[model samples]
Target chain A: MSISARNVFKGKVTELKEGPINAEVEITTSGGDKIVAMLTEGSVKSLGLGMGADAIAVVKTPWVTLLAGTPQYRFSARNMLHGTVSSFVKGAVNCQVNIMLPGGSPISAMVTNAAVADMNLTEGTPVVALFKASHVLVGVPV
Target chain B: MSISARNVFKGKVTELKEGPINAEVEITTSGGDKIVAMLTEGSVKSLGLGMGADAIAVVKTPWVTLLAGTPQYRFSARNMLHGTVSSFVKGAVNCQVNIMLPGGSPISAMVTNAAVADMNLTEGTPVVALFKASHVLVGVPV
Candidate 1:
């Protein structure tokens, strides 16, 4: 079977498997790549990635041919911020947001109870998450 | 305070996150660059990035500098047949192994439960993750 992968996927989450403290999502890509993404239990609930939920997966291949010859992720004085809410952790006060960056990587940030109430952040709310380039840690393979 | 960033932390995850889903980690570089990394509930434990945990982080400049350079990840068909395991995920009855090629990055393959039992796979165990250059998909930033 030929597996066609795209840079981004706009699809619905078909299945959600919740382990004791971990979770996995099955996303049916537009091109039909049954992509399975693992997330923390908190993230699963935070993002509300429930069955038949619509979501987007942005893939970044910085070293791949299309983006090759470009500088890899670098830290600088310039402010660089990017992330996507991949999952959620339901909290008594506020829910935690699991943010996935460009590199098929994920990060976690807490949304204050007030902030969540103010922004009314939910599964589909497109809230812009920001961070400095300095916040990113780059690692070369050994 | 100026932060000098470097890519030095590199290792396979031996554990994963526990509770709260999202936790923030600050890394003080040798040059005193306080790099902040987000740990998702799903990955925190698996990454073993606990207090004073050591790993390599690859740092480049301009973000595009690493992209404008030649492809850092390259693999030969023959070498793919005998590569090391860069990452793995255990399924109900089988396991998915992400083989680390000669260069950085990884390719994933599925192995049966028996194979995993026979190989006695562990976190640091090396197994070749192989794929063709043609398998790589490249694209411009959207």
Candidate 2:
């Protein structure tokens, strides 16, 4: 089936930490980008996930949060990628921003037109993308 | 500022979408699931999003899709959460399905009676909840 999520990264499981209620899985993409996912203990067991496992991390675009400037406050989210704005597209209410990570990974984000103007963002601008570990969905190939 | 999204979970940017006019974002919730949103490029810039930024991803309940049984096909939606039916309330046209994620977080989905019956969903039945990145709304704390 055609999935609605826009980002799919195939990676290897580098670490697995299990808790009573949840579990955290770390995936290292071929592009050298690291993705961390938090799921349920049951999911971890059901998927039979372990270190060195080949897994796929899936993320949808709208859930990506954009940040500018140096982050003054530390965030609880696990993933933080720094890159420069490579391109963008404007729309009636929202727009798409493309950022190229230093590791050669391409990331995208959707924001409002008003926020774009407020931040005065443009191509070549430095930015950050944030994602919480729990938002990541990990699946093994069937 | 307050928004219309009924589901608001604080997380960071995990994935993003690049589109002609709009973009998709994927956010990992603290409770160990991801949410996707579609917005304009302008909104992304205005919010100053980067990886690791403390942001809140929001989704309206109606935007959530529910699926039962094991997924035989791949879906494009960014957020696919596997959980159990905690509770539900039926209405004339739409019914709400409350799913309990592994981390003790609750996710609510609005589906049709036909779908519930078709899926044979019950209080303890396992199900998958889906969200497209475009349907998610990303925001940074002011």
Candidate 3:
């Protein structure tokens, strides 16, 4: 089914657990899907969501976006990667774009010299990084 | 530096996004690290986070856990997968594990039948999967 048709659940904030600012929200859908939403602590506060507050969540098919260059698969909007330019590693043909999120972790995305020059990206510049959620594979311990 | 010592930033949730029954929190740590936290929507509401509320986030080193009989690799706790018991393909004997994560997704370790049997895993029985944050390898798009 399309993602939009999936049930939307409203839950409450139970606990802000460990692991460097993580928020957990409990949601129960009409189909009895009891689920949780793991959010950055910052995201929780920004929404004014706190313990015992009601938050709405929906379960839909994965979101996907296609880019022109390569045949890379995209997931949904929920799984996109967004960050800011932290640093750049100069290379012979390409430059490594280091994007930092508000969480203090850094991600490096490679960009062509032409692209870099076109964007005029530098340290401290804000940029939106996008990727499909499916690109993010999930696994559990055996 | 430790993830705990990193400065945590908060952001406001402008919108309510939906995904599958099991939703993963896609977050950008303040230090520019893109990480996912696997949880249900119920978990998000329990934490009292919502649209426009402040969220505290931190960049942390990935969490890594080792499983027996497989190449040791890292797993990202944020990215959780759910699937049915497909079939016992190959690799180790005595284990009937299914690939719950999306097809073509990168996997650090494979689940075995012995492990499922030990867990009393059956077809259609929902399992609470677990992984570490450290296993997520971040790279720039080439």
Point to the candidate with the largest DockQ: 3
TM-score of each: 0.29, 0.54, 0.27
Task: Tell me the spans in candidate 3 whose CA falls farther than 4 Å from its real position.
Answer: A1-77, B1-142
What value of lDDT does candidate 3 attain over all alpha carbons? 0.39
> Per-residue lDDT for B58-85 in model 3, tens only?
3221121112223222222343333334
TM-score of the first chain of model 3: 0.43
Using Cα atoms, each model's DockQ against the true complex is 0.02, 0.04, 0.06
Single out the weakest 10-residue window by summed lDDT for candidate 3 chain B.
B59-68
Tell me the tens digit of each residue's lDDT in model 2 across A29-141.
87888888887565688778889988877665555788887578888989888889898766666666778888677877667778778778899889888888866767786
Global Cα RMSD, each model: 20.4, 15.2, 20.5
Report lDDT per candidate: 0.40, 0.72, 0.39
Off by over 4 Å in 1: A1-6, A30-32, A62-142, B1-25, B28-142
Tens-digit lDDT track of model 1 for B5-116: 3223244222323347555444443433233344455555566566556543333311211111122222111112333556667654335555543444343554433345
Which candidate number has the best lDDT? 2
Q: Give the TM-score ranking, best first.
A: 2, 1, 3
Error of 1 at A122 (Å): 45
Each prediction's total of clashing residue pairs, residues at least 3 apart in sequence or on different chains, is 47, 62, 99
Model 2, position A25, has a per-residue lDDT of 91
> Candidate 3 — number of clashing residue pairs?
99
Query: What interface RMSD do all candidates show, one decimal each?
Result: 17.6, 9.6, 17.6
